[model samples]
Target: MKAATFFDGIGWREGVVELVDGGARLRDEVPATGIPRLDGVVVGGFTDHHVHLQLVDHSQLACSRLGRVVDLGGDPDVVQRLAVHPVRIEFAGAFLAAPGGYPSDRAWAPDGSVREIADADAAAAAVTEMAEAGASCIKVTSNSVAGPVFTDELLRTVVELAADRGLLVVAHAEGAGESERVIRLGAARLAHAPFTERLDDDQIARQSASASWISTLAIHDDPARAVAIDNVRRFHTAGGTVLYGTDLGNGPMPVDLSPREIAALREAGLDDAALLRALSPVDPLDPDSNLLLLPGSSPAAADPLAARPLTPADLKV
Candidate 1:
């Protein structure tokens, strides 16, 4: 099970991944195996930290070897079942929003997936419900361009409630200064790559210091592609943590590793080291699954859509 390239710390470390009947291991190269042959790295076993798993067709995603998924925004019960199911899923259940805010009217978002809370008590209750339902984190929607946005106060309540419940809060931040607003309040992750607003050096530094961002650049649509790329570029330059996310069910994105999205991240200055961390599955609930095996050579800096397969390599003990 020798892999030509695999994620190690900041960059790819070439190595051999050995798998036994019950466990796995990785070393310098292919070691003598009692078994006659080795499987190539598992394609698609990587974690997608931000995805609308409930909205996606499982078959398409299952086609690739996706080992686990982190549903960024969806119903808690649904996410809970997903977590318990065989797929090895993690989730940030529901979009905590102001009453009647964005996605409340979106055709794609269902009622269960949108939990609207007007004050701290209701926010706390909703937060508890999601936590009890076994959610790994909370997701907030602050997409001002789509509809009414949450007031600073209500957003704070959601953050506070999430903290009380020991869950991280991830936000769909958009429009002017929205990214700053969330980062300032201790949001742990951004569901979408920033697009509508340009962040300054200070702001990028602040976000880098505070939160991780999921890159859904391909869904930005061509008109706003450059803006998304530039936002990610600056964020990466500032040493911000960026996660690879496809927002899978949002549009016509590939159900698996999106080459275009990878290219977009590379264009935005995410070098090989940064790129590997962004794609690795290291979510809290999923403390195992030591490695993500992307078979084949990494894409050249120029071509972004170079990722081919994900292999299930040996787990670190």
Candidate 2:
């Protein structure tokens, strides 16, 4: 019987986890058998909801603390091949963009990373390509600040096509009006907290009612970071769902559960409880899944989300 404190991705409870035969079972009392006690806080598996597999040294992921990663943009073939990683991999294939749109010109974007679809017909073709390639969702780029963006006609086209294929559309909504456009066109997720402009209460309310925002808050410089954090705070206040995503592989960022990203989310007013929900994209209370055992008998009370992950061997011990 392993005695440990368990945070079920929401609330904390003192419980004993017994690995009876081959699985962990949570119980309130200690069992009468010999088993190594879990010496730390066991929480739900953490997920980095936004990443780019093409830009990172993915070889390190096999030993990484992350339990899951979602590749927001990458080479479809490369993402497919990397799905065998020990850490669960979910991905959205190639950036579907307007001709001469954002990321088509970015130096870090690898070849086969962008499919510049031009019209409704082209949008359907592009969406079909991604779905056929086994993408969990569709990624659309509407970065009017960087280059040409999708017109309302094209945005509607992509959203409609993606829906027909049973896929959700996640958009890189940037610039003055891009966020509003995509929110209006029904993008299911935002790749980043809208940073370029302060959203009106109505805009935030609309987004809160209709979609979720991924907090890539630490990726920005001071003024933008400040703006993004403010928006996140207000959006969450309005009952908007906030997803903890770092937009990993964007630059000098950690591939693991990023402390800096977690710090920024905390700064944005996500307390331990809200941050716990943000960290776990998948259900943590499942009977079969082994929960994440982080090192430490007790995590920092002031910064509980900063706990470091334990290796598999460490968990067994």
- Top lDDT: which candidate number? 2
Candidate 1 displacement at residue 242 in angstroms: 1.0
Cα RMSD, each candidate: 4.9, 3.2
Q: Candidate 1: which stretches are off by over 4 Å?
A: 1-16, 22-44, 83-87, 281-317
lDDT of 2 by residue, 1-317 (tens): 56666776657766666555655656655434565667677765578899998788877766666777899999998898884354788899999988999999988999999999877888888889889989999999999888999888889888988999999999999889888889899899999999999999999999999999999998999899999999999999999999999988988877777878888898989976688778873343555343666565464442444455433454365
Cα deviation at 71, candidate 2, in Å, is 0.4
TM-scores of all predicted structures: 0.81, 0.88
Error of 2 at 242 (Å): 0.6
* TM-score of predicted structure 2: 0.88
On TM-score, the candidate that comes out on top is 2
